[model samples]
Target: MLKKVRTVLDDVLDIERILGKISQDKANPRDIIGLNESLKCIPKLKELLHLEDIKKLNSAADSFADTAPVVELISEKLNEEVPAQLQQGHVFREGINKELDELRKLASGGKQWIAEMQESEREKTGISKLKVGFNKVFGYYLEISKIHQDKVPETYIRKQTLVNAERYITAELKEYEEKILSAEEDIMAIESELFAECCQKILDRADLIQINAKLLNRLDVLTTFAHLAIQKKYCKPALVSDAVLDIKDGRHPVVENLLPASDRFVGNDLKMNVDKSQIHLITGPNMAGKSTYLRQVGLIVLMAQVGCYVPAKKATIGMVDRLFTRVGASDNLAGGESTFLVEMIEAANILNNATAQSLILLDEIGRGTATFDGLSLAWAITEYLHNHKAVAARTLFATHYHELTELEHTLERLQNHHAAVKEFGDQIVFLKKIMPGPGDKSYGIHVARMAGLPGSIISRAKDILNHHLEESMDQSGTSISPEASKQLSMFEQQEAKFKKDLDEVDVDSMTPIQALQKLDELKKKHGL
Candidate 1:
């Protein structure tokens, strides 16, 4: 099937290029030839479309009108041995116009006359330096040098004087010059008019020709898609008009091609729906295929919508109205916006415009700010996306913030999934596979060691991480050490002082504006 498609494409002429020539202000003979050649291919292409594998191509080709008459007229009228330039003549056929043919013959014979005159004058004057010259400004002239000036003839009428020579014209030379120039000019004018008439004839059927050109272009693209499908082993995805998207053993089309044969791509299954799972919160360590999984789903859905087969074992895609991706971080520093600000702006655009049928891919949504602030924003955004009544867009949210994994328990349509990894003592292997549930831990130190960071820095980072985790557990009502108890006591004292100051405010006798001023003073005094 692919071979047959390629054979048809080989016979297809670039009809668009021909149309471009026909639409030019001054269509040349080469343009006519190009149009004739393209028109001849229409019949062959139409015949090839009869194959069973090319039903779409046949439908498009059937609409094309037979332009054989136009091709015949151009081929018969225009000369096959035309020059690249139109001004050099020989553009029209010999029998197209009698007067133009006669003019060309006269122009050809007159060139011999000029050459013969050059020799005849040299012998008659007995001055070997005497010559005949022609230019646009001076039609024709006989020249004699200063050394031979005494040999000048009486019938030579002085036309002009040169620094070292004299120029003269004869009555015979003037008569021939007029006839040759007039005939050449008339021949060019007649050929141009005849070519213009041919162009107008082609333009008269321009609408039909344009229709055929457009259909041929469509056929070419469809044939190309068929070829790619066969070469890549892509399957036709089942497209449905529902809210469910299911794909079994889906692979990233571009990544698979770029990988070496030894490192085969690991395909993953994806299933999402508006009611069951609208948002999949992905948590994993860096470079663990989280982003690749998100992008693969988006690409598969897009490919299916374009009427092309998708790179998947078995796939079914529902109609998606709009697709939005906020995968990477970028800053508009020149525009006075930080990375976080740009992130928020894009998030706002997605939230405000997305519909229930939209597909959204968000990667590390809030990683530009402080830890608690970023975690809080990511948590809130996930909740809003899952629970928003008007916009329940199917979302794949990839984040390094593990705190987001907690949302799965609270949000009904939100599910937790992570890229699987294998652990070996202190070292870990990235499986590059998606699985159920949140990741057990983020092996940042292992990743840093793999990146070749200094051992001392890695050691210090591990110490700091352990300390923070311990402090977090102590603050959450776990057994506290003496130093943590001291910090907790200080916090208690500050809270007590704030409450006392609030209780002392006398709002009953104060004006509303005065009460605001008094509250502001108290807040500053207590460091609230």
Candidate 2:
């Protein structure tokens, strides 16, 4: 394979050669030369592919056709080097058209005669400041300074007057102008016709040219894959028929290359199957490699399917038909959509489209809305993926909602993982490693402190968090202290009695005065 690739690389011309030739108006001598050189290599490329060792190259080479006729035609007509503008002439080789050559000679001779006429007019008019100039609007003119305008002859017809000069055209000058301009136009017209003919000949064989170009493109891509594999020490992944993905020590391909030598990326293992661990619920504090882990798994699967080596010690990838990712959020304010609305829309797209053989990576799903709403949506999404009758797609869900970790106990196919971290008093060290089991705490306050939040804000946040936890525990009937549990129980009894009294009241049938009297009595009895 390497030998075959090297042979093609040596024979193929750069694609830029033919790209310029493809355009009708812009094709020039350089383009034709490039096309000719490229066409010369096609036959040689086909012969090289026929060699016994070149298996993959044979199929692509068979599709290429010989375009030597077009090459010969262009070579026979175009000059060695043509100017950028076709009107300037020399666009075609000598003898390609006799009339074009004669017109070119006439235009050249007229330019020399005009120069001599300028000198003769100055002498005859006796105006030392007189000069000749040409413009598109007025083909040619003789100019005299305002101070010397009185010296103008009656034979010079005034064409235009400027602030400080007078311009005129003589009979001799006008006749010369017609001849010169006509010859120049004729030369350009003929050259355009001839060049168009050359381009048409090339376009006639367009199919053959396109096929060869495609073969060269495939060869270039294969060579690039070979180079990247050698440089990055990538290994071929084992593709299996079963719906399972197991990678031992997989590294994020792009991230690992971008890190400095001293802070090399820490590789992690990913093992998931549709039957046992279809959904991986990852929990961790901010910036703890959860997003990176999810992305790397998706990328590795994609790379393997496209016939490229993966960045892992070993990998066995099951075939996945589709891949979906809902990774980030941003509001489209102009379209009247908030960040949360956008997040929901993307989530909806994934749930509606993903199949059992699809791989999904959802990072911080439902995070753009209120806490409970976001958590509920995230929880429900996980449930749907786990229990969907027909499609149980492989999913990697990363979220800060630690409440989701409870799903593992009830969900048969759900498993829990966390980005491991170690704490030293107020300081925390992110291990950047994925491990089994859910995280006990998100350490949001610690993460906030690391982000440089004010100490007062961090302290107050901790207090609020503690208060919330206590309230949650008390509500769940799991209070730690006896006194608190008794207080809550008493409050519940009073709440129940108040509801019972309200339920027994017959205020609708009573008169206004009686109703007021009953309300006062109930308020007094309840110690209102």
Candidate 3:
């Protein structure tokens, strides 16, 4: 993903735009922040298609080493330098800090002399010992021992403590303790100041990183723009290919490098002669590389939009106002709409909004419906796209509807084309080649045989198709007008007749068995 973005960026900037600048070797907080901002807006860049994951991957990469470099450096410096001062002060402050440790020993009776004095004071006051604290002005003062003390010894008296009269300790001890504490405070203050300074340093470098990131993010887009300018530089508009994508060789960036030397792609040029007056209809059997051709065109347009080198040699791109795709269809099961409904909705949206500068690829656009309905809808959609919606946006509409070839002469921009195929006696072969003309037939029976269908079933299906096809050919010869409207009318008439019959039936008086009998009669009458 990173490599893809890098390629796109490289394509956009080109050699001249970059002026020999090298890619950044390291990532810092500034880079991370800029990436974050780019990611926030990438989802809204309609010009690029299906690049959400690419943007998200870069966003995650940006965060991988996004620590503030300055802060880390400062912290490292402070930790190394301040330890020496802390060690020196630890000795001077030891006596004051260890006072509790000494008191614990005295309580244990190891200091027999101090224990005797403590016992005497406890006997007079009914207490053993007390915890205490003090500061600079007041040395050390008793806490629990405060209320019990009567006359303290001079040695026990606090000569230094905080300015507030809260605790007490000896002046000699307080003086050294205060100096150690003050020094530690100064070190901490310096550490904090340095960290803040580091933050500022990172911010200072932000502009440069942000600029670099922007350049990288927009690299592909800019490259495409530049490439187009070069391609169309001084040529007359009509001199270019006729609304057709004519590349002598083309390769898929994501797949080209994976092929072995012997199997390496000799890029294939695509010639889609779609113009203000031409819509090429692509018809072929499944898995014959029809989808790959469609994707190649779509990817090319997207690359051009983003300013990158399209996967073609000597490419000439036409302007596309918007690109709409109704390629893959699925269901909105959560919304209770079936797969067919979802497919229709997307197809409707594309037909409603597409403009002449738009590029559209519709793969099996109406396949989710009944055979005749699907073929009719596909034909109408092709006609609409060719004659109306996008007279200029080159389209590659692939479908299984071979009958739609009749529109080739009727519609100005409508042309019939198909993926090439080979037939061996009764066997069929998918050549995966784009050629000029329509497929004479779909090898459904041949495909079934290839899929290991029983020979007996294949023979029976062939017989059934041959019988029906013979009758159809006799009825209308090679040209069969669409049967979709007739089927719809038939359904409407049936529904009306059923409703009329249903109005005469008295359901309220019928028993369970009677109702069942009545339903059976209705089914028989309608051939349900």
TM-score of each: 0.71, 0.79, 0.51
| Candidate 1 clashes between residue pairs 3 or more apart in a chain or in different chains | none
lDDT of 2 at 528: 71
The runs of at least 3 residues in candidate 3 whose Cα sits more than 4 Å from the true structure, single-residue gaps closed, are: 1-205, 216-244, 255-267, 272-277, 389-392, 454-456, 477-528
Candidate 2, which ten residues in sequence have the lowest lDDT sum? Answer: 15-24
lDDT of 1 at 271: 91
**lDDT, candidate 1, 186-215, per-residue tens:** 998998889888888988888887887787
Better of 1 and 3 by lDDT: 1
* Model 3 lDDT-worst window of ten: 85-94
> 56-158, model 2: which lDDT tens digit per residue?
6687677776677877887788876767666667878889898988988888897688778888988998988788899999889998999987889999999
Predicted candidate 1: what Cα RMSD to the true structure?
15.0
Please provide, for model 3 over 134-241, each residue's C-alpha lDDT reduced to its tens digit, 9 standing for 90 to 100.
435544344334544453444555443434332334454445445545555554454344434544554555554455445445545444455554553312121232
- TM-score of model 1 (CA atoms): 0.71
The predictions' CA RMSDs to the true structure, in order, are: 15.0, 13.8, 17.4
